[model samples]
Target: MKLSELGEIGFLKKIEASLPLSDKSVLLGIGDDAAAVRVSRGKTLLSTTDLLTEGIHFDLKYISFYQLGAKALLVNISDIAAMGGIPRYALIVIAVPDNIKVAELNELYRGIKKTASSYKVSIIGGDTSGSKNSLTINITLLGEAKQGNIVSRGGARPGDKIFVTGTLGDSSAGLELLKKGKRSGYLIQRHLLPAPRVKEGVFLSKNRLAASMIDVSDGLATDLNHICEQSKVGAIIYEDKIPLSKELKKAKLKKSPLNYALSGGEDYELLFTVKASYIKKVYNAISKGRLSATMIGEITEMKKGMLIVDGKGQKMPLLPTGFNHFR
Candidate 1:
């Protein structure tokens, strides 16, 4: 049946069923004018929102509604993970075109429900509306972290060492493969369902290991640039030090793996810095988290600027050439 027949309330009833049960943190959820939550003393909350559009951020032809729904939530959760917080609740607002079916939207809700439950997050509330154009999903996620445990992109010092949680370029490489009709399993999934580095973020934050942190949503070059901009420092990354997935390495594409590693957006891995003194302890801590990361670079004075060191130790200017929304 068409959405006009089901109307807003009818569709929302379907979405409500897909949500997880109430938790202690959630004081009130759907059916109210607004959702409410309670928090512990001495803790800070982290909030982030993202907009996913049909042609801009995603394409409906290649992306299933279910995957789109999961991804719509996952990307926002990545922001919380970047700050070393535990995701708790979310408010999703979706706008759908008339041509869309109720089944498609329910599948999308299934995707959202599965992801939220996995992260132990509650879907407190959201709004759905009819759209004249493309399908759109907007999610606002809230997470909490102890005051001291909240990591930011601006904490890096001059001598801090830069590191990344997982291999880079996989998602971007995967996207390229899909566009070319190449069905490499892992690569495509990496692009379709990128995993957030929540565990690593929490471990490092709790242990006071990371000096600065940010997720590689817009690729290593761009995200690292954000840290530098916020901290007022420059960085030098070694070409050989960047971790590239085997799948990305094996992909036959027009762009080099290094280029993908440098400019590919949506990796969702954490890129962080640790003080030189804490490098060893950080290594041990990450071992306990079962995450392997590489020390790719170091923070330097602002005058030194961002550059990439080649294998032979040649330094070249590294442009912030990752995915740009307006470009």
Candidate 2:
């Protein structure tokens, strides 16, 4: 049935009934004017929000409402993960177009519920409104971290080693493959379902392994530049050190997969830095299979500028080519 037939209040009732509302940290959940949540003592609250619009952030032709819903929440979770916090509460707001069926929106919420359950997050509240043209989804996520454990992009220092979790460029490669009418591949799954590195972030923060960190949503170069700018430092990543998945390496494409790794966005992996003294600990973790990370380069002085060194030891300025909403 159409949303118009159910009316806004009826639709909201459905949502309230379908989603779990018994989280211990939540004093009040759906059906309230505002959500009430509890934060443990000595914890810092982390909040982040992201907006996804049809035809801009995603294409319905290639993705389902369920996938889109899950992805919408995951992206926001990634922001919290970058800060090394634990996600706990969510506020979802969506603008539904008239052409969308009520069942479809239910599927969307189902996806959100499933993802939230996996992370032990509670969907406390949200707003629904009618859209004139496109479907727009926005999620506000709240997380918590020990007062002394929150990591930021501004903590990087000169000489700190840079590292990233998981292979890069797969999401963009998956996207490109989808654009070419290819389907049912690892690359495509990477694009459709990005796994946020929440546990990795927590591990790094608890162990004091990362000096600075950011998620690879906007490509390596652009996101690294963010860390550089925030920390008042520069960086130099090796061309050969950027990790690429086997699928991405074998995929035939017009541009180099290296380009995708360096410039393509939405990888959702963690890009972090560690002090030289902590390198041994990081390697130890890796050797013991506790962490999946690779040292790509080292932070440099701001005067040195951001650069990428080739396999032949040639240096070149690193440019930011990641997705920009207003670019």
Candidate 3:
């Protein structure tokens, strides 16, 4: 069957099922956004890559070249964040359409360099090529974590508390507003220049806080489902507990803001779990980033099932509407 017909998640499942078992050096592979491996004594290596094609992942008419470049790097950085690793180097491959000006390309490079500098990562090497159609960017990022500090999606336990960094749905709202050509600065900037929660990730790892973790790249519902599936657990999220920005709350909309908060993508925040004993510390540790972590739910045994409670105290199954990638 064709990929379009199969859909992104279905296509990915087929690819994953067909792949061979990872080598011994590979600590984690295929299923997660990033892969990790044993690199050296007392240090494990983390690597992730992503691709962005013009007219697909982004549209040139609305976004600046600089923001595109920064976002390209930031997406990869977010994968590293999911693993609680310190990013060290990057390799970027670019396919440029000849019609694009050299000066504009330079501005793109400037943005990439500036973001790398802020993260203390170096652009080590990559390939450049000419594209016959449009611009394409592929980036491979490398990071490291202390051998004992690494966390994965498979570590959550029943009764663990679920927490997330910053607000949700802002980026999704930002994109919708951007498409309408509305002028909300924070929303537009979020859709354009979303920040990775690197420091927050590091704090969680170093302090031994999060039992399992993943970034909110694909939205809270989808990403949290990743953790639950890998860990063989269930969850219950409270509708009123989800952190929605004032912009999203006040905006005139067709759907509930809670729907966007649950299903919206591109927030770039961290969704993590912690044992009940350490839940208080999770809240205390997040102040380093000037944002508070919100506890939305608790992990439960798989048979208990995944659910969300609404404002009227009604309970229902929490089905994820996050994967618009296929629909």
Q: In TM-score terms, which candidate is top?
A: 3
Ranking by TM-score: 3, 2, 1
lDDT of 2 by residue, 1-327 (tens): 877677544676689889986777654355321233556766666777888999999998888889998999999888889888899899999999899999999999999999999889999999999999999999999888886777888889999999999999999999899999987799999999899999999999999999989899989998898788778999999999999999999999977989999889899999999999999999999999999999999999999989999999999999877765533
Candidate 1 vs candidate 2: the TM-score winner is 2
Error of 1 at 179 (Å): 1.1
Predicted candidate 3: what Cα RMSD to the true structure?
Answer: 1.8
lDDT of each: 0.84, 0.88, 0.86
TM-score of 1: 0.87
In model 2, state the lDDT of residue 317.
Answer: 98
Candidate 3 on 1-327: residue-level lDDT in tens?
766688777777789889977588888887775788888887899999989899778888778889889999999998898898989999999999999999889989988999999899899999999999999999999999987888899899999999998889888777778788775577678888989989888888988898999988877888888888889999998989998888788877666678777888888898999999997676665555443689999999999778898889998998756854555
Task: Please report how far candidate 1 places residue 19 from its true position, in Å.
Answer: 35
- In model 1, the runs with Cα more than 4 Å from the true position are 1-40, 287-289
What are the RMSDs of all candidates, in order? 10.1, 10.2, 1.8
Q: With candidate 3 superimposed using the best TM-score fit, by how many Å does residue 159's alpha carbon deviate from the native?
A: 0.6
Off by over 4 Å in 3: 286-291, 324-326
Give the worst 10-residue stretch by lDDT in candidate 2.
27-36
| Candidate 2 deviant stretches above 4 angstroms | 1-41
| Best of the two (1, 2) by lDDT | 2
